[model samples]
Target: MATFETEFLFVYGTLMSGVDNQWSLRLWRACGQPSEAKVPGRLYTLGGYPGMKDPLDGEAAWVHGQLAQLPDSPALLADLDAYEGDEFVRLRRTATLRDGRIVPVQVYMYQPEVDENQRIWSGRFTFAQ
Candidate 1:
């Protein structure tokens, strides 16, 4: 089990704030508030959810997400790790907040091979209403 250096978690998919999912609800409950943030990456639609991949060389793109403050509890981290599954790996990355502050945050990166055609050019991911 890897230790997290920061308490901030960057969420871009179902775990993002305001999503009507059980895991999202639990996340919001643990994290009282979240701020709009963006990370340098590419977004792709992995079926019903979105996955984020590191930007390729010379690729200028960003992944819009939220930065949530997580409590200092190992249980929560364990839960999150389990929820994300093996396809995603939690990594530390810098996020630019809406206020222009850059901070280190934990972000989940997609591990499987990505199809270039499936890229989400908008960067932001929103559940279909």
Candidate 2:
């Protein structure tokens, strides 16, 4: 199984504010320096949900999310898969944030390319917005 080395996940999706969501507080007990803040990357709305894309790409946009210093990224990725209905796949990617710092981040990608009409978004993000 592919595992991620970082604890921070750049969530630019429904997991943000308003829409509806949150990680278990129990899980947060072990979650580290999520306190380290960085508005790193651009957010885009696909369908109705947010998509964290490449900042270099002119098409990229940004939204709000959080920098969670999770201790276990692989487990977190698993939880994310389930949270996203077991279909969302995590891809290890690099993102350059609005602050000009580059960091290695994990992004979850949902397959089959959901259409705009079917996409549901929270509008407020924890990362890019």
Candidate 3:
């Protein structure tokens, strides 16, 4: 089985700072500061939010996002899980921090079918756009 040594989460969408997702802000408040990170994947728009398809298939590129440490609370984790719903499935993966450090992080990957037309070619997901 895969194990995670740190409680970090790689967020590429609404869970990011300055987004309208207040729940994410509250969760971030309970954790560490957000740090820039990169994951091998492609970001796609799912109407209101974004999802990432990892391992970068032949046509996709690396995804730009933020990595935040999660608090050591099972309740918080549960809350996050519930918030993510069935649309995404959490998994442990390695991400590259802005400082070039590699760390294991929990990434919520999209579970539903993704249309090639919704792919975010910029490799970055943001609400401001």
> What is the per-residue lDDT of model 2 for residues 5-110, given as tens digits with 9 covering 90 to 100?
7546655556532334465443354554343333334444554455543344553334345455557546656766677664456767654555766677766654
Better of 1 and 2 by lDDT: 1
lDDT for model 2: 0.51
* Position 12, candidate 3: lDDT: 87
Clashing pairs in 3: none
For candidate 1, the TM-score is 0.95
Each model's lDDT: 0.90, 0.51, 0.81
Best by lDDT: 1
RMSD of 1: 1.3
As a whole number from 0 to 100, the lDDT of residue 120 in candidate 1 is 89
- Candidate 1 per-residue lDDT, tens place, 21-117, comes to 8889999999998899999999999878999999989988999989999888788888888999999999989999988999999999999998988
Q: Residue 24 in model 2: shift from native, Å?
A: 4.8
Q: Which residue pairs of candidate 1 clash? A: none
| Weakest 10 consecutive residues of candidate 1 by summed lDDT | 120-129
Write the residue-wise lDDT of candidate 3 on 21-99 in tens digits: 6677777788757889998887898887898887545754688988888877777777777888987888887899878
Ranking by TM-score: 1, 3, 2
Query: Where does the lowest 10-residue lDDT sum fall in candidate 2?
Result: 118-127
